[model samples]
Target: MSAPASAAAQDGVDRLTYAPMVMADLDAVFAIEQAVYPHPWTRGNFVDSLASGYSAWTLHDGDALAGYFLLMLAVDEAHLLNVAVAGARQGQGIGRYLLDKVAACARGLGAESVLLEVRPSNLRALDVYRRYGFAEIGRRKNYYPAHNGQREEAIVMRFVL
Candidate 1:
C-alpha cells in the first residue's frame, strides 16, 4: 500500500514520522531521486549503501514515502550521503525534519559533527544547510559529473552535532 494523500499534504506545523527503509521503498525513492536530481544515484549505489550498513531512513506519512536520507557514521563524525524530498513536497519542512533527525542520531552516536557535500549550483539546498548551521569548509574539484562530460565542484559543509 502507498502513503495516504492527506498525510503527504499535512499542514506546515505537522510533525513527520520517520521509519527504517525497507526494500519495497526503492521504487518510490528512486522516482523522487530522479525527479529532483540531475545526476541521480543508481540502484546499485542504494543497494550497496544498504548492504554496507549505512543508516537509512524514509519519511512516511501514513505509508506514503515523503522523503529519505542516508548517512554513514565514522569514528567521530557522520557523513550524510543522500537526502531528498518527493518533488511535490519540496519547500516543506521535510528536508529540515530529515536533517534534524540526522543531527539527533549523530549526537546519540557521539559524533562531533555531520558532514555533507552539495553541488555548488544548488542554492536552495545550500540555503537549507546554512539555516541548519552548516558552514562550508572546503571544496572537491570535479566531484560531481556534469551533463556534457564536464564536472561540477562539490561544496563540503559541516554542522556541529
Candidate 2:
C-alpha cells in the first residue's frame, strides 16, 4: 500500500518510487503514451521537453513503470504538461498520488496555481481533475485532434494552492 505523502519512497514498503526522468526511460514512457492516448506525444516532444529542462518525472512499481508526469513551473504557476498512469494500473490511485506529488513540487517551487488543459471528451480525466479540486477556468477551441480527422475542444482548469 502507498504511504502518506510525507513518507519518502524508501520508507518500508510503499511500492512506489519516483525520480527525475532520463532519456533512457523515454522508450517505456513513450510506449505508455502510445497506449493511453490516440493523440500521443511523439518521441521528439518528450526529448524536447527534457532538453528544455522540464520537470519530467516517473513512478515505478518495483522494476516496472507505473506512471509519469511532466510539469513546467514558471512565474508562480505550474503547467501540468502531461500526466499518465499505465493502462493496467488506472484504478489503483497512482494518478492521484502523482498529482499530489506534482502539487507539492509546485508549492516548493513557489507556484500559487496549477494549470492544465484537458480534452472535454476525456471524462475520466475530467472527473479526476475535478475531484482533485480543479475547476474549469476557460476553454480552448479545437485544441485537440479528434476522431474522423476532426478536432476537440479543451477545457482549461486551475487549482489554486
Candidate 3:
C-alpha cells in the first residue's frame, strides 16, 4: 500500500492521514498498544476485530504510526471500541482528529450517535471527550481491568450525531 501523506511540523501544523488497518500493520500497532496502556488489548483481540469486520483505521504521520481507532457500527449507533495515540504524539490534537474521522465514518454508516466507554481514571481522555460534546450516559460496573487484579468502572459516554 502507498505510504500516508507526509507530515508537516512547521508552525505547529498537523498533516495526518489514515488508512484501513491491515494484518501487516499489526506489529507496529501492537507495539503502540503495549506502550500506551497498562492493560492493552492482545494481538488476538485486534485479529478478531479485523476478522469480525470491525471498522479499524490506523493514523499515520508520514511513515510514522501516530495513532489508530476502531469502531463497530450497530443499527443506529457506532460503538467506539478502541482509540489510541502514540505516547510521543499525545496532546498534539491527533485524538481530536481521530474523533472527527470517527464521527464521519459513523455518519457514513447511518449511525445517529457514537458510544464509548472510558476508564474513570483516564482524566485526560474524559476531559477530551467532554470538551468534544460527549455526555455521560451511564456507568458499567467492573468494565475494565485494574491494578492489583481489581476491576474498574467504566463511564459510558455518548455523542449524538
Candidate 4:
C-alpha cells in the first residue's frame, strides 16, 4: 500500500518555510534522523557541523519539521553532506524544495557547483539527485558502514550551479 494521504500532504507542497538551522533545532533534527536513517548521525556530528560553520537548514510547516540538509562550502563549491525528508513526508517534493534552497544558498555564496555522495543502493535518493541535474562523477568504495560490519560503495554526484 502507498503512504497515507495525510503523510503525503506533509511532504511540503503547502505553506512551508526554510531557514538556516540553529543550535536549538538539534533536538528535532536528530529525532528525524533517528527515525529515518539506518546509520544515523550522532548529536556530536550535528554539533560539529554547526561549530565548523557548515551551512545547514531546516524546513518547517507550522512548527513541524519537514526536512533538513547540511552542506559545506569551499572556495568554489558546496558539498552536501546530509539531506533528508521525514519518512512519512517522502515523495511529495520536499526533497526538491530542500535542493532548491541549497542551490540558492550556494549561488549566494559564489559557488559554481554542488557535490554529494549517496549510497548506491538508495535508488530513491539517486533519482532525486538526478532530477536536480546531479551527475555521477565517481565512486568511493566501502564508504558507508553497514549493520553487519560490511560497507557499501557511495556514488559521488555533482551539479553545476
Report every candidate's CA lDDT: 0.87, 0.89, 0.90, 0.90
TM-score of each: 0.90, 0.91, 0.91, 0.91
- List, residue by residue over 67-155, the lDDT tens digit for candidate 1: 99998999999999999988777876788888888898788778899999999899999999999899999999999999889999999
Tell me the lDDT of model 2 at 123: 92
RMSD of 3: 5.4
lDDT of 3 by residue, 3-121 (tens): 33333232122567779999998998999999998899999999999999999999877888999999999899999999998999887677788899899999999999999999999
- Rank the candidate models, highest lDDT first: 4, 3, 2, 1
> For each candidate, C-alpha RMSD in Å?
4.9, 4.1, 5.4, 3.4
Encode model 4's per-residue lDDT on 1-161: one tens digit a residue. Answer: 87786676554466888889999999999999999888999999999999999989999877888899999988999999899998877878888888999899889888999999999888999999998899999999999988789999999999998
lDDT score, candidate 3: 0.90
lDDT of 2 by residue, 1-161 (tens): 86664464334226778888999999989999999998999999999999999888999878788899999998999999999999988866777788898998889889999999999888999998999999999999989999999999999999999
C-alpha-based local distance difference test score of model 4: 0.90
Candidate 1 clash pair list: 3-63, 3-64
Candidate 4 has which clashing residue pairs, if any?
none
Task: In candidate 2, list every pair of residues with a backbone clash.
Answer: none
Q: Which stretches of candidate 3 lie over 4 Å from their true place?
A: 1-13
* CA deviation > 4 Å runs, candidate 2: 1-13
